[model samples]
Target: MKYHVQVFVSLKPSILDPQGRTVERALSHLGHENVSGVRVGKLVEMVMEGERAAVEAQARALAETVLSNPVMESFRVEVRELAGA
Candidate 1:
């Protein structure tokens, strides 16, 4: 069987994200006063097979190398079983 995984990677809390702050400021300036503390992140989804451990390792490697920056970001992976190929 194959599984689908969703990986979410976000900037570390200690890191300063000017892009996110700019977006938040723009929102407030545009009259979205209720919007607060917006943070930017990345999402990656893929399908793979094999033991859970192996699949998770593969996903993490991809996340660390291609999808996220280890210096300033953290990532998490969510796996779901699929019924079809």
Candidate 2:
């Protein structure tokens, strides 16, 4: 089986995101006053070949241990099986 995985990694709410704040200010300066509280995060996409349960477990483990920082950041993992290809 083949799995398509997506990991979203972002800073925790308790952590101050200077990049996010800077982007928010830039948006405001560009005349987008309605935009506020901007957050920036990264998405990692990959395809892996494995059993369903095993692939999911591996994705979760990778997200927790490698893709995100436990101290200041958090991550979410999503997995889907590719069909027909």
Candidate 3:
């Protein structure tokens, strides 16, 4: 099976995000005053071949230890089977 995996990483709520604050200010200056509490995060996407369960497990483990800093950051993993592949 071929799976599409996505890992979303972001700073924990208690952590202050300077980059997010900067982006929020930039957006406000650009006339997007409705935006608030902007937070920057990372998405890591990958395509892998394996059993669906195994693939999801691997992706979750990768997100847990490799893609995110478990201390100050949190991550979520999404896995879907590829279509027409």
Error at 26, model 3, angstroms: 0.7
TM-score list, all predictions: 0.84, 0.94, 0.95
Q: Candidate 3, which segments miss by more than 4 Å at Cα?
A: none
For candidate 3, what is the TM-score?
A: 0.95
Q: Candidate 1 — which residues are off by over 4 angstroms?
A: none
Enumerate clash totals for all models, in the order shown.
Answer: 0, 0, 0
Question: Each candidate: what lDDT?
Answer: 0.89, 0.91, 0.93
TM-score of 2: 0.94
Which ten residues in a row are the worst by lDDT in model 1? 76-85
State which candidate has the highest lDDT: 3
Model 1 compared with the native: what TM-score?
Answer: 0.84
Candidate 1 residues 1-85, lDDT tens each?
6889999999999998888999999999999999987898888888889888888888888888988889999999888887765
